[model samples]
Each structure stands twice: as C-alpha cells, then as structure tokens.
Target: LPSAGSSRFAAAVTQHAPAFKGTAVVNGEFKELSLDDFKGKYLVLFFYPLDFTFVCPTEIVAFSNKANEFRDVNCEVVAVSVDSHFSHLAWINTPRKSGGLGKMNIPVLSDLTKQISRDYGVLLEGPGIALR
Candidate 1:
C-alpha cells in the first residue's frame, strides 16, 4: 500500500489509469457513471466523511453553491464516500435543516467495498473508513 504522504501516487494513478467506471447515486437515483463521462470536461472530485454530519454539509453546500463556477470552467463535481447508494439517496432526500445534504446536482459515488478508497491510499484501516 502507498503512504498517505505520497502525493505522487495520485498523479501516477491518473497517469496510468485515469478513468474509472462505476455505479453512483445522483439526486436519489442509481445510475452508471465513469470518469470518461467527464472527459473533455474538468472535474472536481471530492471526498467526505459521511452523509449527515457537521463539516460534511458545510463543504457539500459550499461546493453546490459554487457548482456553476466549476461548470463555467467546463468542469463537473463528483463526491465520494464509503456509504452505500441507499444511504446516499437517504441523505439527498433529507432536509438541510436537519443536517442532511439536501438536493445536490452532483454525483456522489458510493465506495461500499472500500476498494477505491484503499487503492487511492486514503482508507482509514482501523475504522474501515476513508480520510476526507
């Protein structure tokens, strides 16, 4: 496994295998998406701790608020977490007033198996979670 300090890892991964195809949840719906889907378009791929949490919403909303800015730059935003697709839908359906993500215009990939997180070297082994 690569160390968290390996900044070169991301570059290496992107260089060797830049695109990944997978199933993700968007607007409370399950759909298939791929890195190729954003090809020819810049992207903002972010990771968060969990769905209904403190810092998570602040960042999610902040990104959502500025999503158009990213799009203006010909970019798309994709978020990820260890939660399942069901959990993602639940969060999306939840109201922001109750600490949920509300309706987001971006795809939130569910790394349920944690393989993606591990391959990216961001997985927190002890807790079976990933560091955002």
Candidate 2:
C-alpha cells in the first residue's frame, strides 16, 4: 500500500492482485480469508465504501443475485470494505430493504486495517474509507 503523497497509488490492472489476508463474513459466520486461497481460479473482487450505506447494499446485492453468472464462467465474487467482520455479519443478517446485504452468496470481507483498500488503490485518505 502506498503512503500519503506517494506518486504510485493506483493499482495496475494487468498484474496479479496484491496479497491480502483478513477476516470475512461468510454465511453469517466469520472466517479467515486470503488472496492465495483462490489461486488457480478467476476472482471478481470489488470494494465498497462501507456496509449498510447508500448504494453499497444495492451494488453488492446485485452482484450476489448474479452469483450463478459468475460461477458459470468459473469466477468467484468477493466484496471488501473498511468495516469490521462484525459489521459485515450484521448487515448480512439484516433485510435488503433496511440497507442490508440480505443473504449474499458472495463473501463480504473486512479490511479493518485499511491496508487492503490502500493496496488496491481504492482507499479515500481524507475520509479513512474505501471508494467503490
């Protein structure tokens, strides 16, 4: 991850994804996750600003609703946010109408350290959050 004022802050599209390890909410349970765990398969990872916020649930749910589509092409979807695993679990347990993820098929990961978001070049330094 680049520090503030670093000129190289953007992630390279064609390169391998940066290595990451963290706790993630999976099916209402917390589990350890790592980038290497998905080796040999395509990964469709995305980062959202945070959990239980505007547009975040809608986007994640839309991705979850198309789980089969990703699977059909041999890919797995993973969503990341600056929130903790507990927050992810809470949102997953809530209903969609109430700004929750609602039975998401994809795992919602917690980048609590903000390192993953920074490494991915999506962290918003001013707000201490991620950007999409």
Candidate 3:
C-alpha cells in the first residue's frame, strides 16, 4: 500500500483519511486507538517500515518528542507498522543506545495483520512490510 489516491506524508488527494482502529501502545500501556478517537482534528499519521530499525527509531522519536508541538497545532501524531503492539512496547523499552525507540509519546498502532498498512497503501506485498 502506498496511498489510497494521492496521500503523501502531509499532503493528500482525498479529504477523508482511511478509517482504522486497533491496539496501540500509549505511554507504555496498550490502548485502543481509532481514527474516530481523533475526530474533528488534524491528524498526522505516518507509517514506518518497522520497529527496531535505524531510521524507524529516529522518526518515531522525533514524532514523539514533537507531540506537544503537534498538539498545539490541533494535530495528533500517530505511527503505524506491521509489528505487533508487544513488539512496539519492547522496542520502546529498548534504549536509543541499543538501537530502539526508548519511548513514544504518540500512540503506536500495530498492524500485525497488515490490514491497516494495506488500508494506508504502504504495505509491500512481497516483504509484507509497510513503506515509510
């Protein structure tokens, strides 16, 4: 999956973003997150290749660190990957020194079944991983 019609990073083709709801790790705990939960607000949704990777950690950390700034602008940042929530939590627990996302402020949704990634048009059929 690359994008529904023309969604790119912060731009778009359609006004409506794909609908999704799933288990997400928020503040070190598992919680249900959905597009409806952020209804009426600008959403900054990004999909990374996977957790525990080089660029992935940097991207997640950057988004997490800027969560407040995003909130001030009435936007909620969300990161999604094909990994499970448990994998996300483990990666979050791992320190940056060890090449993992120390912690994340935003909800990290798990697209374990790859459905979410597909919906977002970022899943690679061959590798079964989402593109960043």
After superposition, the stretches of candidate 2 with alpha carbons farther than 4 Å from their true spots are 1-9
**1 versus 2: better lDDT goes to:** 2
TM-score of each: 0.83, 0.90, 0.89
Per-residue lDDT tens digits for candidate 1, residues 11-114, read 25444333455668876789988777887887777777777778888888788878888998898998878888888888888899998888888888888877
Q: For model 3, what is the C-alpha lDDT against the true structure? A: 0.85
Q: What is the descending lDDT order?
A: 2, 3, 1
Worst 10 residues of 2 by lDDT: 1-10
Off by over 4 Å in 1: 1-8, 12-18
Top of the candidates by TM-score:
2
lDDT of each: 0.76, 0.85, 0.85
Candidate 1 has an lDDT of: 0.76
Please tell me which model should have the higher TM-score, number 1 or number 2. Answer: 2
What value does the lDDT take at residue 95 in candidate 3?
88
**Worst ten in a row by lDDT for model 1:** 1-10
Error of 2 at 75 (Å): 0.5
User: What does candidate 1 score in Cα RMSD to the true structure?
Assistant: 3.6
